[model samples]
Target: MQNMWKCMEDLDQYLTYVGGPAGALALTGVAAASAFYLASRPSPEAPLVPLDGQSILQNKDTPSGPEMIRVSKFYKEAKNGKFLSYFHEDTKTLYEGFRRGAKESNNGPCIGWREGPGKPYIWANYNETLLRAKNFGSGLVAHGLSPGTQTFVGIYAQNCPEWVITEQAVYCHSMVLVPLYDTLGPDSCSFIINQADISIVVCEDDKKANLLLDKSPKSLRKLVVVKEVRPATYQRAKNRGVDIVKFTDVELLGAQKDYPQTPPKAQDLCTVCYTSGTTGNPKGVMLTHENVMAALCSVMAQLGPHKPNKTDVLLSFLPLAHMLERCCENAVYMVGGAVGFFGGDIKNLADDMRALRPTVFPAVPRLLNRLFDRAQQEISGSCLKRTLFNMAMSAKESELKRGIVRKNSLWDKLVFRKIQEGMGGRLRLMVVGSAPLAGNVLTFARCALGCLIVEGYGQTECTAPVTLTVQGDHVPEHVGPPVPCNHIKLVDVPEMEYYATQGQGEICVKGSNVFKGYYKDPEKTRETIDSEGWHHTGDVGQWLPNGTLKIIDRRKHIFKLSQGEYIVPEKIENIYIRSQYVEQVFVYGESLKSCIVAIVVPDVDVVKCWALENKIPGTLSVLCNNPEVKQLILQDMVAWGKEAGLSSFEQIKDIYLHPDPFSVQNGLLTPTFKSKRPQIKSYFKPQLEDMYKILM
Candidate 1:
């Protein structure tokens, strides 16, 4: 006690020597703050809590001789000889689901859109939207579109009210909906039209209608223009014996007569979605009504408490032609949530978000990465701001570790409020899919946006999502357990040395959600789906200890170096693209070579900024030819590869900086934003050879 008093006396003397009572009080406050910060920080030794249920191994025999893995609910149900096919008992078809949603929400907003830039969204209530859908269906009947599963209705447009109306109309008439996008090009569009035997197509505008007429599909007999029909387009269509009519006129014609609704059976075909193939012709994935409903139910079941409600709003920007966007929109519609589409321009997405204030946001990794890069650039200008932002992120990350998400916390209010507001302040949930998001970007999005961000894994054949990250689970890399509708198992790829017993191999899925077959391609369908009904996804995945799935490599994209080491170019490209200097990258390797090389599309703004800082002068095209600029990007990519723990063979040995990006228009990238490997290699054959020669 006497010694403690002596220490206190010494402290008081030190405080007095430093300043006075004010200094003492300031030091005390600092000590308290430090203690609080330490307390709130996540413990280094704390165990990570598992976010998903345990995977139950099915004892049933499989073709590959490995036990299938399934979630407990599904395993139990299968064991009991029962399976879930729908979320709601009465919701058999998409049309029935929409009707149920309409009845539930009543006068609530169903779909909304903006008239022009900087304008508030105009909403159409559930009943009104349903009525319009009916009118449109009747109009189709008036135009000689027969109501049956055999009838195919093509919709070539971006996401708009008209697209949804057309889709619902097809559902109401028991017709198959075939979606087409401009990115697919005229040849592919014409092929789809002829393949589906489509007589009439709903075009977004005159350009699409004219493109269709120019292609002159053999089956096309009429053009239904959502926007005004141009005189030239009308004349061209008239010359081809194809009738051109406005969308409103079709609705008016339908309203004149009461067309009986012909809802499709559960097993009836719903859509023939064509994939954005990397090579050759695009394959049409035929999904039945049961297939789509099962996927929708599984997604909703996985969402659990975070499922969309009547009050929720989703911003529709991703192409409606893609199954991911289609499934997400259908999920929203199934629950009576409002969907507001973008203003047809990706540049204006932020403005649209601000106007819509969507509660639920579905995004792709490309956009999230851009947002992350923008935030980093903003903070790079000020060291003090950067330091505070880092501290705030650290605190939020600690809270996330404890499974807590807060939007009104002190750090959120001060540091992340602007980020939240930028994405529409009401955002409570975000679903990211279509590609694997960088772990750091995923973490930053969750922390900065202060919302439940989940990543899903799937493809067009599965009708959208197969697995989704669990809500309130902030772990980054792994896509969570399989949804209830499907059972997941890994098949050994002996050539790649990936073994199912070791929990690493090609992923295979079997469930109600699997598509019926590839449209008109029985051989391709048979190749994709094995005799046991398992769809062999070409993706290689590792089953994490927590029963989650981490995508490791793609079997189809895997190649080997001369040294006998296998390399996955997509994985390497994903790593290199993390470098701020890179915008898009195509990593190429020859089996005879010892190392890989890359064709990098440099980020123009970042490169210019770096050039200006270094006192270099050149336009982007000129800079692409500069040796120093190439070295700069190569060094940065190498650094990123090293940081990512990539092997020596995986590290890009050399790089060619290209000013022009690989895009759909250039035919070097697919419509889905995947690099068309053969085309890309052909396009840059000389550059690629030159880089290897320099390395030699």
Candidate 2:
């Protein structure tokens, strides 16, 4: 604390020396204002209390341990009208599931999208989706698409009715669906198209179609334009032996022909989902119809008897290329629920939620964090509001401590009720996955949203979720017990010295949910999925006292310094991010370095407020590069590291403050929001070299 005061005094002296009394006065005023604002706002309630080595599951009489203990009974158990065995194993393919679902509720609303925020809505019933899917399949056949060949068909589009139709058509025609995220750049787009050997690509717009055509991979022999195609662009494609077809033209041709009678078998190829490639080139994850079915069905079994049905509505805004949203889409359809699309603009997502009035919401942690941040920001805007909000939060925290948070309380009516209405008052459950959520954020959301918020854990290889919090479970630290139909175990990671006996090691999974293998990479496949059929997830986890799994870090991401100090950058990064000053951060260390270096993206609002208080001269971007500002942030990080109880070597020895946050568009973040460490390191190589040289 003395050191911080000394630094501030030195900064003030330096500013006065540089620009006279005016500069010093500005710094003093800004600092005072920042201090006042921070002091006025109430601190957020702390993260949920830990289990204190007691097993919550055992205490509650829930089935305990690694969860595989009950796998056999759950797999074969026939309770109520549910199937006795694996029902998904009986379904030949996803197309069959869709066909059956469509048949059972032909008049039910299926797919829907809105033109814009508060704009007109569009929808298609189950019968219409089935009819269009049939037409789409026949249209593909008319274009010489051979069934049973497992040809690759790429869908480079967002979540829309057309994307759904294309997916169904791929399944109906016995072709493999390869999804391309809408945000993918040309290089990644080319790499995936060529890697997957995709012959036909369906794009959402002319811009995306043209971009793909520009890459013009040799395997891409046809292009289907879903929205609009100009004559000149069509002629250009035709000249290159690339058949250009309109989405409507394909449907018309399909209407003229009969839909194929034979659907792919259960074990046949379904989709080749490519990883977001945070490390290097993305690998194509080959999933069979059975694999997808198992994953979706496992989720259903985990949900118990109350599965989503026709009365439920879900808002789909996440990229379809990602496994979670894709699975959510299929699962909603499987349960015969209506799916609504976002209004395209992210800024209006809250409005979309209210407009759709969705009953179920499946989301990622980043989205959930944003929602929490927005709520807090609004509350902090006024003194009276902040006081009321703090009281409500305190009441909620008291309820959490007493294990009565799930019940209606006075705070709910006084505060949380309006918050819930903002998120479409009908929402019963919200599933969060794709990334670990901050426990405090999770706790606040459950209290604020007035709905059950379940955290799920899994990767694309397992289709979606491997472990999910049960409907009644509210523990925030653990992700929850492993879902039925899947078994998980921990194996010792010798290099990191993590052992299963100590309740920490690399997570390994085996079940119907695991993917077949990486497409065209038998060596990698063998490496990941052992002879025993257990897929080594490369994720580090520990068993909580409750027998639920808690992810600690990524095994592959751990690095050792020259002094043999093992460090998990992600773990450290998470700690640093807890500070309000940090927006995003990347920790870098190499074998030759005895200490770590960091690249940080400051929370602009926090930094700007601090800059004003310190009388720092410049805009937020300029302040990022100012030596004093940089040093101040470094000091803040050092203080945070101490607060987190990090080891000496784990502390950042030096840092480079980046003005811009890592993002997908800049290739420093994956579509899923995980940092692309290699890319980030490469992008800041010069800055890193400079820091190392200064230390030398």
Candidate 3:
């Protein structure tokens, strides 16, 4: 143990001086050194399962639930479940699944992207896509990889067709894939590589490669540059015994080599997806071929209209590293649909959306909220427009609740048609996931957009889906019933006062969709998946009246105040955000504080409007610090809290309104657009402390 610690220290120090592939090799040497030391020692008793870290204990009995939901149930119960017949499910492995889908629609255009707005789209048909995947797989073999070798491949890129090809190649060759999000920090990139023991990495560009170089894991042996590599990078990698190759070269080499005939097995390890860790180090969720298959099958069984068709086109902008986007890509491929990649820039997503005119769009809440906010801005531009928009929105909401729509609806045609047309007129469905969608966005989209909005709840551990809202059953608050693949039940969370018997408790899921375990972490695996094969999700949920699940709060995020009063910060924050005066908020309370203090970022547009309404003159910066403005916002927040039924102790006592909003660029928001509370608290610790003192 002491030797191991010394070696790690040496490795860390050594890595600071090295750069590029050499740095990665130097880091990998530490693992080699540890292996050498272990080899020299006297042999210890080997575990029964050959000690690959998984527990050797026999499987236990399954837990009791309200009968596990099955595909047949989905077919019988879902609103448009008959569409399940179109799903290609005879194949067990993802590679085979892709093959069957591609074969069924060989010459159809599949993936597309453009250089910029008005640029002609570059496309690849299904036949071309499959050929490229095979060539990429052959390239892996040419690079001395073999099927069933437990090789780990890392894809460190943003959303691109190459990302999809590389992913499919890795799976086709039966290698485990570790996806590193483009937004991840250098340290996180290294941590994932080390945790997954990835030997080869395909980076998006030279800058991303350099980021990996700063903290390159010792396990990394090769760097595959997708765009281009600098000469210095090549030299650095060469010096460190790392093989650096261009993606095109790999494909060319693979085209000359024989492709592997053996495909991935159903239970084969598919991916090691590391969670976007908020509080601590991210854990790698080990998903299998079976797990992904189950998730895909379940989605098809539930979201009937979502099954893509020949004419269906999708806009892909979200980070492909996210499971939701990845699963959507797979589903699109299965149905022989087209996916139009964004123009490699988020600032241009709107232009891309308008140009592509996608029929299917999968979005996170942040994007939807932005659209809603934009509509509000336009509507509020003129009093007449505001009144008309409100009338249209209200009428549509009524129509939605009544479960009916009129052909060539007058309100929709006059007031909301422009909004739909602006978003490329042909949108049929928008699937929202990754985080809870705001209620206001749901209400507005349902009435104004005239497109189906499906909001669902899921985590990475369950292959990105466990429950989802189905077509024709748009209960925005409830994340539809558990999908066909899993059985879900509630378990008591005593400390948080969540009770299973009362239909409110921590959600526990069990089925093929549940992950095999966390990669290389048996203790964490045991903690997550119990003896009864249930994955104990830390989220709290209650059964909705319609037999669906309503996620309330996180069991792990509830913190007790100084007075021993428990506070669910998310609930309070959500309530406070309902006020148009706020943009973003972080609720913080230490153990010594009797009341919570908030860090708020006011909505500049709304606040400016308020200043105008009250005949106060100032810029946003001035208004943010104005005592009168602060008091006005505080009153609204308090009112919102009271309306939410929060206890007095739970109400935010004082606030430090921040001028800047919480964003991914500032390390305050995750890639999914969820607030990173720990980072935010740390960033504003001094301000929060002063505010708490004032409250005291």
Candidate 4:
């Protein structure tokens, strides 16, 4: 503290001493303010954003840890459901129906290869799945192979039993399962495999097999293919010295059932999920059984116990390749919960939701954002639609505001129940995570969907599940308390400077769920995990009085403007992308800017609709920059910006509505769907330069 004061004294020239002692006090205040400015600090109450930071602060702005813990105890006691528990002797015992039914998994809904939508009565607990995974794993180990001490096996398929089969088999046999994006190309797909020294790879279908087979890296030895992969595909692959084996061939060597082999220890490594690679090169995030167990415990501790007897059905949509889906997969297994796979491609989520409709669901903010955007667009483009929608929305919003948040509502019955029914009418808990969600989303999902909605904060490094908002803590943007036994701390982080002067700081976490370290990178591991065992999470966060953790943005993401104020682009982009016309947005203006700027990928349908209304020529995308088109988009941007109460400095000064969506094919985005800001800015410099030309 003395050192801080001495440093302040060195900047005495800027001090104003206008009224003697009062003046000196003012000067002290000025010094403190300067310190805050130098670090781009926001006080505890005012986070950089309202919904995210404000909601969190409401839950945690209490005096001390004990006080917050006390509040947590009260909430837990008040919660309607049972608390989640780790699998004990009692939980491990199989129910009579489940034990008998699991053995005939092949006859029930085949969740594996050649599967259709889902006959989920078979679920994740299918006896066939357990046998297949165990046989494949044990056989591989017995083949005189170490199986794997720390190798990466990338799973590049959609939601199928093969995905989990390969994962469970490998992990139970002491290998790390690396889930890859099904969209990655040969070069990028092989880059990480080579970098991580992966030798044996298990993938669904021959397409992925060919990727590994084509310009194959030398480090990889055996290529294991599942489902659609054929023996013929290996001919080209074998020329390159890669031993291509079938999943069936690999499974031929193990004990069937009734004679279960050794189980995986808690500390053995389990999975590795690649980082989004938005900022730089992709990294392989290695997780162990301990990490997976920790995340489950953390999540379960907070959500309370799952009532398997209640017959909960969880819909799996968001790519199973993601850590979020993987975590849910593992958790459901502990409770013997049924898992329903979403039908159709990613584009048909809404359509499929109406088809398979599970009891519980998990989604990213982008998915939830699309839902709201679609709802608004439905209401906007029509007159009668707008009137009815607005009436229902207003009533629903009012009930939410009045704390009457539950399943019984006339507005929901009339206007929103259809959406719920489309999702199979069994949604008990709708979980959202992986990004910051708007409070409005939480409120609407609760009121309209007639289910408990949850939001959480986590990273790939932590094996995904961390602090999650409990069911009853339905407040917007508030990520609920730390999972059962985990510890979350708000340290004075250097990353806090990027956010506006709302309360912000770096969030450090340590708990049963935190990772051991990065795979094969000790120096990097040491840098992230401090001596006291706390992981230095790069995120800046605020805590609400109720102990919900609200993440602002990454500490390293803070970029300065020419006017000297900081701008957190992530927060700004979330606001801009709320428009129905917008499909993707990338906000920039880090260094030389009086304010912020953005580039956008507008939806073709929305643009076409606008183009027709305005009688613009040359098609929607080509007409996007037409004087008429630009004017129309600009009006929406301006109106939306104002509605969010944003200052001009943070408003979008220019937009290039690219018709092209960022894809791995174009190298514009990471496989995880996060925009590569630097690449986008560097690629579109001309338009960016031209954008400021007229605005100034």
**Candidate 4 structure quality by residue, lDDT tens digits, 1-696:** 011111122222211110001001222443453344335422222111223222222134443532122112312421222222334432221121223334333334324221343322234446776677788777566543455445456666667666667766765555667776633446656777887777777766687778667768777778767655666777777788887777787788655422244445555666666663233345567666666655665566555543222245566665666677777755655545566665424434444455555767776554444455456655665665555555556655554443344444444444665566655666777777765666775666666676667777777777776677654344576676655434555665532243223345667766555777766668878988999888888777776554466665555665544322346677777777788878888887733234566778887888888777767667655876676676677678768888875556668777777778888778888889877666787888887887777655
- RMSD of every candidate to native, in Å, equals 14.6, 14.5, 19.8, 18.3
lDDT of 1 by residue, 1-696 (tens): 011111221232222211101101223444454466566553332222245543445554543366456553433474333345797778988988888788777768888899887999999988888889899999999999899989999998778899889999999989999988754667888999999999999988887888888889999998898888678888889999899888999999999986999988899999999874434577899999898888877877766677888889999877788777788888888888889988775546667888999999877665565566666766776665676677678878888887777676656656677778777889998888766777898999888888889888887888887788876567888888777778888888986789988889999988888998899999999999999898988989988887788888777986644332446677778888899999999999874455799999999999999999998899999999888899999999999999976756578888888898888998987889888887898999999999889875
- Cα lDDT tens digits for candidate 2, 573-647: 988888778899999976445578999999999999988888887877898889887887888888899997676
Candidate ordering by lDDT (highest first): 1, 2, 3, 4
Question: Which scores higher on lDDT, 1 or 3?
Answer: 1
Q: Each prediction's Cα lDDT score?
A: 0.78, 0.71, 0.71, 0.58
Off by over 4 Å in 1: 1-54, 60-64, 72-83, 558-696
Point out the higher-scoring one by TM-score: 2 or 4.
2
Stretches of candidate 2 exceeding 4 Å from the true structure: 1-85, 88-92, 381-383, 394-410, 558-654, 657-696
Ranking 2 against 4 by lDDT, winner: 2
Worst 10 residues of 2 by lDDT: 15-24
By lDDT, who's the top model here?
1
Clashing residue pairs, candidate 1? none
Model 3 TM-score on a 0 to 1 scale: 0.71
Better of 1 and 4 by lDDT: 1
Q: Each prediction's TM-score against the native?
A: 0.77, 0.71, 0.71, 0.66
Please write out the lDDT profile of model 3 over residues 1-696, one tens digit for every residue.
Answer: 011111221232222221111101233444453454334432222211111111111112432353322222364333222212224447766777776667656668888989776786789998888788788888987887767637888888777888889988887788888888643556777988987777789888888777777775788888888888889988877776677898988899999986765678888898888874333467889888888877877776665545666678888766677678778777777666788887765545556767888888887664555456567766564665666666557656665654543213555555666667656778877777766665777877776667777777777898888787755553466677677667677888876677876778888887777898887789989988999798988888887655677888676766544322346688788899998899998988763345688999999999999899999999888888899899999999999988866657678888888889999999999999998876897899999989967864
